[model samples]
Target chain A: MSVLALSVILAFVTPQAGSTPAPTAQSRQAGDAREMTLTLPHALRKGETAWLLVTVGMIGHNQIQLTTQSGKDLGNISPFGIRSGQAAGTYTIPVPAEALSGRRLVLRLSVPQAGGLHRATTTEEVTSVRLVIQRFGNGN
Target chain B: MSIYFETTRRDFLKTSLATAGTAALSRHLALAQAPAKYRRYSVTSQQGQKALVSYAKAIQAMLNLPADHPQNWFRNAFVHLMDCPHGNWWFYVWHRGYLGYFEQTIRTMSGDPNFAMPYWDWSDLAQIPDSMFNDVLTPVASAYERYTKDLQTFTAFIQPSLKNYWGKLSPAQIQQLNIRGYKTFDDMWNDVSGWTPTPMTGHLSHPGHFNPENTAFAPTPIARYLTLQNPQLSDSVKKNVSKGTVYSGLEPTNFATTYYQHIPIANPIKIGFNSSTTASHNTAPSKGTVFSTLEGLPHNSTHNYIGGGAGEGSPIPNGPWGNMTNNLSPVDPIFFLHHSNMDRLWDVWTRKQQALNLPYLPNSQQLPSYEKEPFLFYVDGNGKQVGPSIAKEYISMSRFGYDYEPGYGEEIIGKRNLVLAAKHPTASVEGLMKGNAATLTLSAAAIKTHLDSDTATSLFALVTVPRPTENSPNREFDVLVGAPADATNITADSPYYAGKVAFFCGMMHMSGMTDEATFIVPLPKRKEAFANLSAAAGNVAVTIRAVPSGGGASVLRAVTVQSL
Candidate 1:
């Protein structure tokens, strides 16, 4: 399955309305790669820890790069311990201190191929996800 | 009654002294009041443009002098004086003093004692004045030739100087650059980069640095990118086009009618000078409260729009105007004019507040520690470099021998009737998933009446949320105005699409000061959408959808749909 196809599936399964998040999944296909989407809470509080439940679709090494809209690289998530085609362990992605400056942070996922002819040569493309961190304890 | 009216001789003498003392105090106050020698005129007017041209010429002459000269000091002082007091309580007072000093310097240099700085009223006339864009006042033939020569000389100095500075980069920075395969300073500088240079401090000595013509005032990196891509055009053409893009990107028409109209009179005064108990100061307003509407909406919008892309206008970033970012904005000549108008708006808002018997901080009492707060150091009238002055001394514009054009505030106040449309009850949203939306239904009749009554009719979506903590990440929400069904996937250019409700938390939010944040977006005037609603629905619905760019819990507490 490609990343584009995975994205469509993820959009369909996700809850359409309301602020609360339910366990949801999406997938999209891009070329020969398959990408699965994980839902994050719509809003985050400052200094709060956020977890991403990665569902492994392909057997490869995956990393996540977070950036701003102006393309300022924030930080990266790496060293995933997940097997192909299975639900993976929850990964802890610490929000950086500077990341709390009221600007949207975009997360881009990359899956590097391994052990094949193209081993260590290319990474699977994944759609970027956005995260907004709100001020803590501020009632909406 | 006659017995009561008769006073004892001792009592009469005491009363006479008291009356004489009162008269003397009044006379002293009158004497202390400086004459308004200079009148600030609109940049759009002929007299205004002429005065600006004359002032620019005087500045150019002063720029031609040696670096150590006092006349040259005035030009360099602007760069230094502007580094502090932005995105804080000191934003207005600091600039007010800076402008006052600059005006005096210009007057002295030009030998035109009556010359006052002209203001660019972007809120009213959304376009850059023709004078600034064209060579109407300062003929280009001579100035352009001089500017080209000066630019070459400055570039020669800067390029080699940067190479030296590049060698001095921290070992970590040098290693990172080396890892990126940057072999030389020129190679690093030439790289197509997103990295912004750390702001420079101290005085700039070159004539090119003083002349606006020698430098392109593109504030955003994208504008610079576009200019680099289109190098075939003359520098003048590129500058003009850049200015045009900045003007268009500001979305002036939508701004004046929507965001500008929605700002309550008290907001301009309260945001910077709000008392400790007011909504925008130390304590945040209750959830869903609409406060600091001016500061959070039109004021921030203009800054973001002009400085870069993050507010209304084209969703893309435009080029640089020094007015875009708070720190280096004063370097651009337009900064003074833009700020002059802002100062005027504050005055206008204060006048309106006075009329309504609303409480406000007087100029002298604008900041709590105003009297003791050291602003910036600059050269005084005596040609002596003065130590930092306190905020209280710079509060009154008249004290500096200048005043804005008479009745400037009245003109702005008169436009309020168009903004006085019926506001719908506030709708609260705790959070929203991407593609999900919250809608507020307003009376179609009220909207129609407002549209029919005014040619500048525009719908406004006012979103108010509790102020985010100082370091909280910025969040943005897209608002769509129209019937509910047609509002999906609306582009910024669409009449149904209102602008983004953005929370730029960093400098704007001081730590421990919990103020409410409000965002007002002017919806595009989609006559068809209004017509469709009028044809079928009793109520018009405005929907705010969360864009995928910002993922977090919703900060939105209340949204109001207003017409202007």
Candidate 2:
């Protein structure tokens, strides 16, 4: 094998902490839903705003929700009502002044199945995402 | 049959300069014989600023009139013309017709027969002109109030609610109260939000809402944040402003040289070919190649950078520019100026292509039903309202009596030395696995030298995915340039987060076909990262992996990166 090819192979084999796993063909297949991992800031103080930037493969009629660990809804993503696909945008999520007591937050992304029924229910969806957010003291 | 009209350049000039009498008639006749000679000026120049102010005044006057009145007709035209054929083969041709009619309306209203529209050359100036922000002309607050009263009277006849709305205010009360009038042409153009006096809704003769307070009938939040020279913005915002203000995908130095200079005239692969034989009506080849590297890169990048959302944590965080969006863009006057520059670029590209004896596409191909579609109406030279005419009628600007100022291209291509070290060899890798990374090598010394000299030196990767069928689900891919180990961890916040590729329905469903959907990622600043790579690896390697967007499998056609 060439030096370049060797480097590529070795780069794959040598694993490091927090490294993103290479997506296989099966992971990217249509209808084979996969969980999307977003890299958000570790913690937000009370009354602080964090801009969550998500890159979705398809942005159809979907909704991304942010809430507490026990499922108290913070808010639905704004600039919503997406009609097309392959979209990217920033959503501003704010931690209220009262939420300083919480230690953790969760972001849930719900995308309805393409042609399947049960469009209203979020629990039984084919592709769903949950990202945990760590919290810190209110600085201000 | 092709409508053949020929006139000498001198006659065209005379026709453009002649006033609205018998001389204007003769000039109009001359116009039919050949292309007219109206020079489009840059907005930064003295003449260009003057022309823009004049246009604002004329549009303001039009705004004051009733929606159906002759003066207001031009302002009303934008509502119907937008969100149709942008980002496709017809983008240039349709706008040419749209702007041509608008210029005629301006001449009729302003009475400056020689008046031509000025273009905002963002690629050259890299910022919205200061004149666009500062008040250059005296405020016409009283005149605006008078027009608003006139509009109130006009609309009250159709909608009684407007009569009730206006009954509360007297002329004396109106004069005492500060009614918002345009302080600058930018003030008039920047309001894209919605007009004051709340547009009329129920039982109006016109189909759309009318804004009596502002011309263009739409309100825009004076994009005060758009000025690149403003010092109050944070360093990060300033950086975003600077990068977003200019084309980041290609080096200004080698763009015109390596790409445009090397383009062959007759090569259908570079510039699109005409499949139809109809004289004077060339159709874009249904399958042939189009768009040279330079044109395609700057064109799409400018659209996305400008219209796409402002950076996260920006002063106007996530606020999108109207110029970036398709449907509401025409409402912003900058839309015209930006498009005029785009048209100017097309003109330059055509000239360079023709110099090499390029075979022009038969009538410019348009989206379905738009080939011969009429786009609004405007008052002609004889004071007669004309058009609702097809785009074919306005194909050539000269045919309509205007041309860009001489040497506009050369002026933009002014002395800039090409960084030979910045140029990277074109490399392609097959089977670029989704989420799996592969690296392409580049000369580290070249990257360091380019960055050491120009802090704005950016790395751009052109990711080409095989063209998908019309029904393919939308897919997006993220590209990064750095150490192979760090490739997977690079989020949108990471400096290595170049940008993403979005394959939407509108792009895939467009009439003309592209061999591949080429996405240009303006890689974030990574000079130090590049330096580290150069010290250790002797070369910079760019890694690209498909971010799992759950669409069709992405088949890599080619991937090339260069320092710009």
Task: Give the TM-score (vs. native) of candidate 1.
Answer: 0.40
Q: Which DockQ value does candidate 1 get?
A: 0.03
In order, candidate lDDTs are 0.38, 0.38
Identify the runs in model 1 with alpha carbons over 4 angstroms from their true place: A1-140, B1-35, B77-82, B134-328, B362-367, B381-383, B406-449, B452-564
Model 1 agreement with the true structure over B210-243: per-residue lDDT tens digits? 2221123222222211121221322211221232
- For model 1 the local lDDT of residue B2 reads 4
Residue-level lDDT tens digits of model 2 in B1-564: 000112223443353343213333433453465445788888888879889877776666565556445345323343322113322345566667667767776777677777888986654565556565443121212333332224344233323432332344344323322222323323323233223333355646554442311222211332123443641322222232232222221111111111111122211011121111211122211111122222233333333233332322223322333333333344345556767786776665444333222322232232334355444333453434463456557656675777776433532121111111122223322323434454566666656654553223344455566444556444555444453553444444445544445555444445655645655444445553453554555665555544433433334555656554
Going through the candidates in order, what fraction of the true interface contacts does each contain? 0.00, 0.00
lDDT of 2 by residue, A5-103 (tens): 000100111121244432211112122222222322222221122222222223222333343333433333222112122232222132321222222
